[model samples]
Target: MNIRKTLATLGISALVGLSAAQAVAAGTIKIGSFLAVTGPAAFLGDPELKTLQMYIDEINTKGGVNGMQLELVHYDTGGKAKEAVGFAKRLIKKDRVDVIVGGSTSGSTLAVIPLVEKDRIPFISLAGSVKIIDPVKKWVFKVPHTDRMAAAKIFEDMKKRGIKRIALISGSGGFGKSGRSQVLALAPEQGIEVVSDESYGAKDTDMTAQLTKIRNTDAQAILCFGFGTGPAIVTKNVRQLGIELPLYQSHGVASKKFIELAGAAAEGVRLPASALLVADKLPASDPQKGLLLAYKQRFESKYGPVSTFGGHAYDGLMITVRAIERAGGTDKAKVRDEIEKTRGFIGTGGIFNMSPTDHLGLDLSAFKMLEIKHGDWTIVE
Candidate 1:
């Protein structure tokens, strides 16, 4: 077998005969994944899968982690929770992946939580939802800043501007719904009132009606909490209706694709995001600057522009690998314990300090408030 070729390219033929223990004995570590690689949420999962493959390939090239070659067994969930459940089961039962790093959406991640916890396997989710780790499931950890964190960051920014009585337009999907709930739950404390609240279906073509409704309200600003193209459409609709009330978006649309999709309408739009989007603009003193720049260069060179979603995958995979290294092997229990013990681990998102009660290992500081300026990302102070 050519060691240079990524195990992801080896297909099932290579993973067939190795039992979980046998695979470890044969100097291989399996990392199973189930992502929405091809679906409405493709924007989130496509780059995620690519980032995983790229890093795994690079890691294997420089002598595998702890002298063991890494193998990936991934499945496409098409952004569906039911499909995610089936694929996750396959990964746990058949592929026997020592650790799982997947779930492009909150729905998918939440669906597979029971399975991972019951099976006693370590799972690092890439999706952004507080519920994924809020209750603190033993076997589950996550990379992206939670939706609740995003909400808090946005609310803090709004408070800074002395903005009150805001409108909320959200998507009905998992991330959007969760983010909306958090925003509502946290707004009262910030002295922000929900002047108008509306939601659009995940596949909704037009949000002009929602924008019109929000415009009629006595709202000071509008916050759109949604993922994929839905928020982009909302951005366009807000512009189309001439409703320029200082729009804010959730971290869901932190990718350059949102700017491209929403065109000039995206300009002046503010959102919470990772430093990955503005790597070059980050000050040299920032701890994540060097790592973010390196990851940006590598990913953009191989793929196109890097997205925060991909960065989430980068953190998840590296965190898992580091946990395995700390555990000295892929013993499930030990790895899980090490993952929970991760502290001061700098990643593309932020410095992680996980604990028994906090599996996500990130605070509001993990998100940098950003705005779209001149068709590019600009840091918002």
Candidate 2:
């Protein structure tokens, strides 16, 4: 998608500014965002922006929240940490946004942690990293499942299949680095041995060298830790090298785009992901099934296929809006407190039960073991 051109056209009416009616409305609640709209991580950030703009317009049509119209002022960070930090500062100081919701990657999210903490703005990150909330930054919260949770989920499945030794091929990006670290730290606890570990740069197109090295190891299975197009390349590389070992990927690639990118090579690939991808297949009684279907239908009808990254944006926006309603207004402190008190919130990601200590508010149950079969996501029982 031409996100740059789309954003340029949207800037006049939707995303970066308010409409004439909104400007003269009873009041306005400013929501600031910074995302990787045009970069290596555009696949993640593009859907997120589409979801936000679509839903925010929907919400505004419903008379906004607490009688005040919502204003979205966002910037494109291009997946850069330094750029994210600068935009975050501008969102807080210059735009004076009530809440900030963006940060499409762990590195970008982490870069602005100190700024959000010091500024005391209610910030909800779409990134997936345990470090974002491990120490419990008062103002920061996240929507996506943490990388640590993804690691534990994958290892749990590996143990179930009795796979003991595994090789790791990971990208050198933020998600890959954090996921690799988590896997290394948790492997021993799960009784799984890391036989060999290989790394690749973000821009690397070929991973045959890494897969060849991993093939020589005594590892029984391979776990790829990376996101974007990197892991997909690894998947294809593994198949090209005739590596018959079972392949596992991190949740960073839990979207249909990965399967499309990897093509037939994605067959038999497994990863941990939210139930959103297989919403139609989920049990009728599942709490998140209905919400997931609704989100998927809405997004697909307006834009294209739904993605897990977009679901993160959906949950983040809804949670923030719900908090605003509960607070009875847009009081930043009150909204943040309400957000912390969020209980039994059925989002596309999972049921969130936020508390003082836990900002992410999700357990391992949020992730489902999904395998690609015939170019589709099939739940692994």
TM-scores of all models? 0.90, 0.90
The TM-score measured for candidate 2 stands at 0.90
Model 2 misplaced regions, further than 4 Å: 1-26
Look at candidate 1 and tell me the lDDT of residue 299: 93
lDDT of 1 by residue, 134-158 (tens): 8888999999888888889999999
CA-lDDT, candidates in order: 0.91, 0.92
Candidate 2 weakest lDDT stretch, 10 residues: 14-23
Evaluated at residue 139, the lDDT of candidate 2 is 96
Task: Please report the candidate that would top lDDT against the real structure.
Answer: 2
RMSD of each: 5.8, 7.0
**Candidate 2: Cα lDDT at 263:** 98
